[model samples]
Target: MKIEILGTGCAKCKKTKEAIEKVLKQTGVEAEVIKVEDIEKIMSYGVMITPAVVIDGDVKLAGKVPDEKDIRKWIAK
Candidate 1:
């Protein structure tokens, strides 16, 4: 599974990426985690907010950080 964390390197975006990584490590899930910082690339995803989470090319969470439960559920897919 491919996970994309979209942000411009802000604190919340960093937190979001860390949270997802923590969950992945705890669950032993092997997936690619990418940090998208390019404005054009991010806007192409139709996300106007930072700290968005995209799983397998689909937008899952946006405008905020996701909890552990949310990360687990997303990785399950």
Candidate 2:
């Protein structure tokens, strides 16, 4: 699975990345995690908000930081 975190490197973005990382570590899910910081690249995903989470090229969460439990559920899918 591929997980991409889209943001402009703000506090919320960082938090989202950290939360995803924590969940991946705790769950031992082997997936590629990427941080997309470029505005053009992020917009290509049709995400107007920072701190978006994309799982396997699909937008799963957007505009906010998701908790570990939620992240785990997404990853499991």
Give the C-alpha lDDT of model 2: 0.92
Candidates in order, TM-scores: namely 0.97, 0.95
- Per-residue lDDT of model 2, residues 6-28, tens digit only: 99999999999899988889989
User: Candidate 1, which ten residues in sequence have the lowest lDDT sum?
Assistant: 68-77
Best by TM-score: 1
lDDT at 23, model 1: 96
TM-score, model 2 to reference: 0.95
Q: Residues 7-26, candidate 1, lDDT per residue (tens digit)? A: 99999999999999999999
Off by over 4 Å in 1: none
